[model samples]
Target: MLIDAHCHLDFPDFDADREAVIERARVAGVVRFVVPGTTRERWPTVLALGERDDVSVCLGLHPYFMETHRDADTEALARALDAHPDVVAVGECGIDARFAETLGAQWSLFDAQLRLAKERELPVVIHCVRANDQLAKRLRQLALPAGGLIHAFAGSPEQARKFLDLGFVVGLGGAATHERAKRLQRAVKSLPDDGYVLETDSPDMPLAGHRGERNEPARVAEVCRVVAALRGQAVERVAEASTTTATRLFGG
Candidate 1:
């Protein structure tokens, strides 16, 4: 079985046939999913989804939606984590340099989440984009006891190693399947057996041949195939390694 280490199954895109989507993923050998909450307004839906035996949940404020988050949201997140012992991690949080205007605020929010994770001894599920170096620096200084997963990682092999060295794992997904993503593919090829996990980042990051359509957990099987080909390993091996790493980072 495989786990979609990161997927937004709570998004409205799947509201039409959510169960069908999950069934398809299970049929395709993707047995579990990690769903992360992006905002306070969405936490109810995110938490509700966690009721499933096959779904794990995480809560945090995403940098992309900085304008909607208030200063008290971090404290709210702490309470949410306390109230929900089933939450597997403390994230969907990290710095996204693409949003230049909210970069500073993003750092503050991300830092707060990191500290919360440390205090709770829970791992994190990060959403890094164009700020791998900066994020890595913060992670190193904090040295979270439970470590974390850098979801949908698209950095170089060297950068991947930095996270691994800091007791974290990089997540590989649809981005690594594109033929033009030579750099990311190289990073995938160089990853150590235990240094990476698989994710679909569903409702976004559609795979290569399915670019215009909505992505889903079912497609993570294709991601495994591509990653196996990239690393010159068997598909089953990639699936097992990634699932193992994901399970270790975010318990069932």
Candidate 2:
């Protein structure tokens, strides 16, 4: 069974047939899922989805959603984490330099989430973008005890190595599907299979051929094939390594 290391089943895109999407993923060798909450507004939705036996969930405010975040959201997330023991990880939260203004707020909230995760002894799920260097530096400063997942990792080999050294699992997904993504493909190929996990970032990041189309968990099989080809391993080998890695990282 494979693990969709990061996704948003709570998004409205799946509202009409979320169960069916999950069922299709299950049939396609995806036995476990890891969905990350984007904001306090969606914590309930994210946690609620994890009520199912098949899904494992994490909570955090996404950098991209900084505009929607209020200071109280941090307190609310803490309460939610305490109330829901099933919340296994701390984030899809981290710095996103892609937006300079919100970058400040994102770090403010991201640091708080990291502290909460450290306090709770739960792993983290990072949503780093154009800020891996700073993210790595801050994570080092905070010294998080419970490592995490760097979702949809599209960073340099050096960045991947940094996160892996910090006991993080480099999340691979549809972002690596593009033929012209030679750098990402090379990084994926070079990354140690033991420190890597598979994902689809479903309802987003559709593969090259499927660009402009909605991505789904079931389509992760195509991503698996892409990873397999990059690693020069059989698809089953990719699946086995990723599944084992996911089980170890999330204990699913």
Candidate 3:
């Protein structure tokens, strides 16, 4: 079975037919999901999804929503993690250079969550965009005990190696499936057996043919097929490797 290592199933986009979406994913051989909380207000919804045997949850403040996050959210995240032992990670948090205005606050929030992950010995699910080198530098300094995932990773092969060397695994999603994504495809081709995991980043990053439509966990099967082709390996091999890596990183 394949695991969708990162997906925002808690988002309102799935509110209409959440069960049907998960059922479709199961039918497609995608059996597990990791749903992350982007804000303090969403933690309960995210945790509720985690009650399912096949779903795991992560809580953190997303950089993209920096304007909504308050100073107390980090402390609240700590309490939430303490209250929910089943929580597998501490993020959906990281730096996004696109929001230049909030860069400084993003770092502070990201660092707080990283420290929480370290103290709790839990993996983190990061959302990095155009800040890989800077994020990698901070990761090096912290050397978190429980290495995390660089969710929806769109970095170079060398950058992928840097994260892997730091005990973190890269996440491959629909973005890597595009024909013109040569750089990302090259990164996929260069990954080691345990260096990456599969994700859909549903309701956001639609796959190549499904552009302009909502993405869902069911499409992870296609991601596996494309990644296999990129790495010149069998689809089942990609599925097994990605599932194994995800299970190890976030637990079953």
Candidate 4:
């Protein structure tokens, strides 16, 4: 089964037809999805969706919305994990140095989640950005539980190798679909088959042809198609490998 390791189905953007969206994605051969929590406010919604057969959930404090997090939120997330068996991982967490001025709270919240994951023994799904250096350094300092994937990874080959060596997979998606993303494409090409996974970060990072449109979980197939072509393999092989990698990371 194809698994979108990262998506935001709980977001209000899909309120009108979220079920229909999942149905269409299933019909399009996208069998499963992982929705990561952005804040305490969204955890209930994500946990509810994870009760469904096709959904897996991760409780986290997303860096972009770190301003919304509070101390209680972290404690609440910890208490909520055992409520469901499909609560697979503990993130959608990490740093986003693209806007470093607003990053202090984000780092604290991210570190909190990492500490929780370590204590809980859950893998993480990080959201790293231009702050690879700092992110990598902090990760080494904290030494996360079992490592995690860097969602929508856009980095140099050296950075790519560093994360892989540390036991993380490189998530490839829309960013590598554009021709102008030369460095990202190179990273994707150089990454080993066992070290790469597929994701859409849907309703956010749309592919090349569908730019400006709502990216959905179904778009993961196109990403598979593109990345497979880049790696000189068939789509099915890419699908199988990515499916296995995601299952290994997030548990399906």
Candidate 5:
């Protein structure tokens, strides 16, 4: 079974046909999805989705929407986790270098989530954009107990190695499907068999040929195929290894 290790299925983008979207993915042999929360307001929707058999949830404050976050959101996240012990992890949280103004706030929010993940013994599903080095440094300072994933990893092999050494698996999504992402392709090829997981950050990172269209979970199969070709391994082997890695990190 293929698992989309990171996706935002609760977002309004799929309101019209979320069920149909899930069905298509199921038909394509994608059995499970890990949906991460972006902000406090979206937590309920994410939690509701987690109640379904096919979904797992990770709650956190996303850096991109820094203005929407409140000072109390961090405590609220802790309360939500305490109230719902079944939550799989603690994030889609990390710093975004692109948003210069929110960098400081992002660090505080990310640190709070990391502390909560440690306290609860859960893994994290991180969202990092152009902040890999800083993110890696923080992870080294405050190590995760259950480990986690670095979603949509597009870094050099050296950077990927740092995250792997810190016990975090690199998540490869539609970004790697592009021929222009040779560095990421090389990282995918050279990563340890157990160091990578497949994802399709749907409604966001479109594949090479599917630009401008809304991405979906079914495309994870294509992601696996791309990773397989990059690694010179069979698609089934890639599927099995990634599935094992995901199951070990977040469970089935």
Candidate 6:
């Protein structure tokens, strides 16, 4: 079975047919999903989704939607973590250099979640975009006892190595399925067997042929196939390694 290491199954995109979606993914060999929280308001819905046997959840504020966050949301997150013993990690949180306007607030918010994760000894699921160096520095500053996953990772082998040294597993997803993503494909080819995991980031990062359409967990099977081909390994081997790594990092 494959683990979709970063998906938003709780998001409205799947609400109309969530169970059917999950079932379809199950039949397609995507047996589990790790859904990360995007806002304080969505935490309850995300928590509800986690009640499922096949789902794990991470709670955090995302950088892309900075305008939706309030100062009290961090406290709310801590409360949610305390109220939900099953919470697997502390984030979908990290820097996003693409949004220069929210950079400062993003730093503070990301730091708060990082600190909470450290205090709780939980792993994190980072959402970095064009901010790898800054993120690497912050990770060093607030070291986590349980390392994390860099979701939807698209970087050089050297950049990935930096995250690995800091005890993180990079997530490979639909982005790697494209013919033109040579750099990411090359990075996947060179990644240490245990230093990466598989994800779909469904309802978002659609694969090569599915652009402009809603991505789904079932598509992670295609992601697994592509990654295995990129790494010159059997699909089963990739599934086994990614599942083992996912269990190690997130423990679902």
The lDDT values for all models are 0.93, 0.87, 0.94, 0.86, 0.93, 0.91
When 4 and 6 are scored with TM-score, the better candidate is 6
lDDT of 2 by residue, 115-184 (tens): 9998998889988888888888888887778788888888888888898888887888888998888888
Candidate 1 on 24-115: residue-level lDDT in tens? Answer: 99999988999999999999999999999999999988888998999899999999999999999998999899989889889989999999
- Candidates 2 and 5: which is better by TM-score? 5
Off by over 4 Å in 4: none
lDDT at position 222, candidate 5:
97
Which tens-of-lDDT digit does each residue in 1-252 have in candidate 3?
Answer: 999999999999999999999999999999899998999999999998998999999988999999889999999999999999999999899999998888888898999999999999999889999999998999999999889899998989999999999999999999999999999899999999999999999978989999899999999999999999999999999999999999999986
- Residues forming the 10-long window of minimal summed lDDT in candidate 6: 134-143
**Candidate 5 Cα deviation (angstroms), residue 180:** 0.9
On TM-score, the stronger of 2 and 6 is: 6
The pairs that clash in candidate 6 are none
TM of each candidate vs. truth? 0.99, 0.97, 0.99, 0.95, 0.98, 0.98
Question: Where does candidate 2 stray beyond 4 Å?
Answer: none
Instruction: Give the TM-score comparing model 2 with the true structure, all chains together.
Output: 0.97
Worst 10 residues of 4 by lDDT: 77-86
lDDT of 5 by residue, 74-115 (tens): 999999999998899988888788889878888888899999
Could you report the Cα RMSD, in angstroms, for every candidate shown?
0.7, 1.1, 0.7, 1.4, 0.7, 0.8
Q: Write the per-residue lDDT of candidate 6 for residues 174-194, one digit (tens) a residue.
A: 889989988888899989889
Per-residue alpha-carbon lDDT of model 4 for 165-241, expressed as tens digits? 88888889899999999998888889887898899897899899897899999889889999999889989999999
In Å, residue 118's CA in model 4 sits off its true spot by: 0.7
